[model samples]
Target: MEIKNNRLTGATFVEANAYNKTAVMKPDAIIIHYTAGASGNATVKLFAAKTSKTSAHFVVSEDGTITQMVDLNRKAYHAGTSSYNGRSSYNNFSIGIEISNPGYLQKIDGKYYTWWEVKKDKKTATPEDKVYVGKHRNAVTTMTYWYKYTDEQIKAVKELCQAICKAYDIKEILGHEEIAPGRKCDPGPAFPLDALRADIVSNTKKDLNVSELFKDAVKESASTSLTIGRVKVKLNFRQSPSSNAPLKSSPMAADTYVYIIGSDSTGEWYNILYEMTGWMDKEFVEQDNTDDNYDGELTTNSAMLYNDQKKSRRLVSDLKAGTKFNILDQQENMFRIQAVVEGWASSKYITKI
Candidate 1:
């Protein structure tokens, strides 16, 4: 994962001819994105086309193959009219890396589908490979089936960002969604965007490695029973499970039901998430009540079970017409039911026993 001559990204450049001949760019940041297209080669070719009007410096595939399209020393027309830190039009000050991903997937029928209306198997689409299911900040769509960044892709991006930082004196790393906010949402939460910058750009480690990633998943996930926590008081939410890991911008306020990622090595810290990953002292965090009283039965066999309120949350396992479940919670038009399978469904599609 070395950059040579600001052109060859680890001995590969996909001949990116569709770029502006601007004066040399003294890059200060890296903006990450997802192609939302089919594959790496297709995305590379699309950016190479002069009419595409969008291009990235590099495109990393799902399997971690790096294809340098635009030279790192030049500005790639990736982020349009994006601003950050007083710099408007982010393309001028950043190198863009578009990873090949489907972004958020829409599950349909007994199968899962990409935004392009391409169908894939449920098992293949949302495998527990370096991915986590969660909600996003300031976005209507909860990540029912998040497109995960592969382990190989994660490592490659880490090395590539480190190289770019050193090559161009890059000072910051950001996502397309961050720079453009309401207008864009690439490289979403599931991709570990923060963890990438923490590990490579800022030299910190919010390590979501194999051993610790799923260590407490069964015990902490919605599968076992959602473990909701409340902060006793204000607590420092550091990046990694360490007291010294660099506090995230936000804090765990008193009595907030935080989303739990996992626990620390010492079990003294509860790796939690409000918007992003951070650690708070476990002692101050208390497991709040998770009991609910309603019991119900499905009135119809065709009723759809979803991961969330969004009916796009199609679950593979279906409950028979007379199946029973315990209602954990209820929102405006959806009911969170469990026992048979933990998920949400339209209240109209189910009935209480």
Candidate 2:
């Protein structure tokens, strides 16, 4: 598909022999999993093989590179016998992303099954080189296994979640264990579920109102302006909502600073600092600070001009002082004005009084 936005990417059609051709799919949920293989390449190869009887829509490597395996429109075999929110057969209607990791733990067998011991020989069983085995086992099964995912793997998964939430009208995200609680547990305790969910929910919620959320997120993520004379001064360090919180007070100047993030409808305050998000106070900032020198001479360099048509060249001799002009906008060297008087005195002669 054309990848209309940041939604899911098109599948690369790997190891798809087991996919149900008759299954109709419309993704409403996201299923996360871990490929308990030794390496990402090996995991990809395994899923790509036609005989594996299992496939995910995408496989994210430890380094955050994503490999697509199945088309978003078609069914992938990853979610076997899974259900969520009263819906069954999730494979027919969900995107599955298998993260590459060794899983919860690793297993190593010392002295490769001494042949003499296996044969019950009285002589001491000669030891052989230790053989490593994958320890991750099915929770429901009797076998014991261990595999550990790397930090990079977890970060990659979170980013992938953000991307997926951005693209689809996804209502909920799930771990494989959540979908098949009795059978699966690939994404173990190491996977930060709360943090991932927070990102997904935050991104998905923001996409519903790109402009508003962007503005709000921007305001919330950064400090707001305070009028000091005609200039809008920014706080040296953004403030937060609480008095005791490290972010609540500015370490720079102790002036009255407003937190931009906290002005949401909920009445909470937050401020953006270095692009990082934090809570702050709404009372400290004003949206339309009237004292912003609206009474000053409507000049071309007042910092409010926003268009190109008004900044055209004009001679300095054509502007008149008492002729009066409303400051529509002000920019670098030009001022956009709506003429209040018809007579022209001089062009470039216009100066802010």
Candidate 3:
């Protein structure tokens, strides 16, 4: 297939030297797993070893750093005996991402004891114990083995998954357990599959033809007044709506104004503005105010008296200002007013004075 986007960076690959070939397959799904190892480096070494015969496309560290062990085009040696949606050979068409974690269960008080240690019971055979030795029930020491994934790890996974989805036409993303079921459960219940899938779906929808949506928004925003404290703020321009793009120069000053050009939403980054337009913080621009005045008052006619036939008419201009007007009559749409200048000005400017 054509390389529309390349998001697989920071990944390391190992060719099947013995087979004298690499498993090149178009991935249809994303399989998530746990390393069952203490660290990402350990997982990497395990995959690198020729005898291990196990590897994944990516290995995410506890802090969420990603180490690629295989190329996306080539199949990684993960998902052994896995099936998804009634299909088999998952390793051939799935991208495997392994998170560094200790295996499902561990034994504490064992030779390899760490802060997060698992305890295992040592069996000793004696005369009395010999009877139960065949069915020995060793008293195991219990240590606190916490299964905590750091925030950084979660963030890294989210970014990586989004990038992958953008690069390939990958529609389905699943955990190893979900695909393999009875065979494996690396990415266990602790992983937020539902939340992750929801995010992926939302992002995919957003990425579809976002430029067009932005263009439409810009066209619709022409009539709207984008003001900051009565003066229009300058737009911080960008080549794309994404924040990752280099910042473009400000196009207008606080007093100058422009129309909205376009917008796109990428995860947390909302790209608004195009080359024809410019980027503006969503917080800065106020939507169009169609009303004539901010205070919501009505302009007046020649008379300034209360027209009992009609209703009330609000004084549009401040009465204390240089142009003063007397209330003759009030109407729904028309305002009757008699105006006089501050000093003895000319009556030419005033009507019904």
Candidate 4:
């Protein structure tokens, strides 16, 4: 955790996008950023790309590996359109540290997923301690989770900050949120901003409690079985109770049997078995004590399979009287059918068996 030759030798130095090209100025502040991507390796490469308009002095991975992108004397184009303490441009007076994080989690239906659509499963998933309401960088406060920044990451950041301050005489350390406020929410609530600063100022090191930071969720309770409901539309089953979670490679079709624990707080996504228990939207899917499995028989000879509801949709295939197809979802007069003839069929032409 030391700086030599004007660079953090512990960090891999690679020049990336250029900004603030004037005579290198001694940076007095540090601006923290989140890569908002899945992995640190991928994010660092993007910064190295000439077309990428962003670059940071250093990047910290989820595993705590550090990569230096630009020299401390040189400015990194990270804090865009940002100002702090009478300073109009931050890059000119600050060294930027990009933290590797799957920035935000978006819940679509009931499942939790990352912005990159990576599924958040219990094995690797960390339940958010408390849901944040109100505007996030102007995003309507949908239920969001605090990413579990690892202890390794925490120590690394502390060490890096200590090293940077010792070498450059930096006066204050701050997050991107403090600088941009409503326009950004990086190094978010999940980050212990106040404590981090305190540790640096007082030089008293303390480790943040992971349990106090992340929600401890037991496995979905027993005595309840959740299966994907029958629906006319295709449903996205995710690894977590968020639509933002990585989608189960295949859409959950109607009548697809799914196991459930319970609905998320929103009472939308129902957990099921996929990559060892994820979430599926409750609307187009469902969870019930009894599995809704049945057979439907066509009553008419000229019945046609459609991509959507019967009358107004284009035909998907043709079917004959006395034909049997497994039911996926059922509407009043149209049914989504699976098997050899997989699509929507007129309910009048089919009878439940």
Candidate 5:
């Protein structure tokens, strides 16, 4: 599957009545939800109603059929009064996918029945295999019965997510339950949310290497002083310069390297390029003051590792060719290397990695 012009190529497109038509939305996250209804067509029809007042981008049926209700570029009213990683109102920057499932089911007389099914007086019991018994992440002690997602539906959602990530710089795959924990629980415990996220996001990062991304960003951006920074702690990579901005993804691990391209007006947030382009707090990043910061490899057969950068340097050792070391500091025509023997090496004999 492929996405073109913010729409999936082989999916059925149906316009929804509820969405932000005027507001510009650059989605970087996907929020998964359950229809809580009968089928994908039912949810599509509901979204098409003039009085629906709520909408999602896509809906997946049990048989793996997908119906797109809203353009991927538009804001669909999926996540209501939501927040994640200190950012609020997820609809502004996330695409929503509604999987067709009955959601949490009610067990009566050892038979599982959807709340909607019971309301219609039909009272048809769901199959045992199709029902999953588990506790919602938001629940304290209540064990709930949730409708299990079909294998076909799961495969469809995975492919759809992968396609979305390939089309856009999608940084996160979240459940509606995660974004609005107390208020909502959808694509619930029955769904393999974490596994799907790990599979899709891991592949996305592999498809787009970080250093290659940095080079592309640097080429397109205006002139700025580029520097190196190491994350001092696990830090949030935000879409904007504020703490309230949506997170690019999970927190970057401590000691992750990033390119500091620029800063916000307050100078408290540093615009960075690493696994992805985002903003990080300046306080949590250790900026490399030197102009050059990189790993170096010795080119000569016998390169001298010196203790000091002086006319008459103290010899530390003779390093063999292709010896790799991190550049710790730099002086005129000399670089301090963190090797077996921490010392200086001539710049001419070292090549940047």
Candidate 6:
């Protein structure tokens, strides 16, 4: 589990069929993904095929075996149309790791099956204990089922990520869903992404520049006022809070949720955040002011809420055990909840009622 000359030693190397042969990238991040296939060998074979357009640096099998499909320094076409932290096109800046998984599953006739397996009436049903049910951050509220990752695979991933972070000074570890939400949901809720990220970053913080990067990120993200608003009608998202302000892009559709940051002097214009930050007319944006809708409660004796999700240490309020809260939103392990206060808390400490 050691990185040597832009490759992992002691891991099987399988040349990928497609990758950027010219451009070499100094990666600062790692993106985790699920194969959505049966095994790591299948994905390895797919990447090795001449017709396959997708490739990744590494793939961890169900039994914890590691296989390297592409060189670490080369750009693998794993992230498509992705963006995160003001950076777009992640393939050029990050290493991609594909884990063997069937991804989300559907239950029918008391048997759990993958999406394709259900259509074929496949008799090989996943064990009940291997299915994880949870709400996706992008989804509104309803829970979804996904295949669980084995402890062995998780252990291998953690070790591999740690080695990469140490060798390349990697700063951020992200899921594919975070970089390309709505379009992808691999390495779903069943993966312990947050814990893994925290563990890796915490151990590498002293040597790497991740601490400073995280601080800057937290500062930038904290600029948002944490006000949720709904678009009342289709209108242009302007660069400024005036009618003469230039539009950022196409008109935002009605019912789109935005984070209201500030407003103009007249209070008729609101600065908001959707896919991008811009100003929208206050009259056309409805602010959320709903009553308490507690569907979860605190399990810990004490838990602190933060104004935003980026800064883990920033405190808003401390709640005692049995404190009821409503899950307004989620980002990784952090839940934007409305409990005694409207702020973010670790989902690890909250259980659904």
Best by TM-score: 6
Model 1 stretches astray by more than 4 angstroms? 109-111, 118-132, 140-143, 201-353
**Per-residue lDDT over 187-223 for candidate 3, one digit per residue giving the tens place of the 0 to 100 score:** 6545666577667766656672123323333344445
Please list all clashing residue pairs in model 6, or write none if there are none. none
Model 6 residue 30 lDDT score: 91
Query: What is the lDDT of every predicted structure here?
Result: 0.66, 0.50, 0.50, 0.64, 0.78, 0.78
lDDT of 6 by residue, 197-267 (tens): 76765665556445445433333454643566778899889999888998998999987766676788898
Give the alpha carbon lDDT tens digit for every residue of 165-210 in model 4: 7687575577887565424568765666657775665552333221
Better of 1 and 3 by lDDT: 1
Go through the candidates in order and give the clash count of each. Answer: 0, 35, 26, 19, 0, 0
Model 4 stretches astray by more than 4 angstroms: 118-143, 204-353
Candidate 2 structure quality by residue, lDDT tens digits, 146-231: 34455676776776666655555555567776565434665655566646765555564565312233234334323543222111
Q: Which ten residues in a row have the lowest lDDT in candidate 6?
A: 211-220
Model 1 poorest ten-residue lDDT run? 208-217
| Predicted structure 5, TM vs. truth | 0.60
Against the true structure, candidate 6 reaches a TM-score of: 0.63
TM-score of every model versus the real structure: 0.54, 0.45, 0.46, 0.52, 0.60, 0.63
RMSD of each: 13.1, 29.0, 28.5, 22.2, 22.6, 14.4
lDDT of 6 at 280: 92
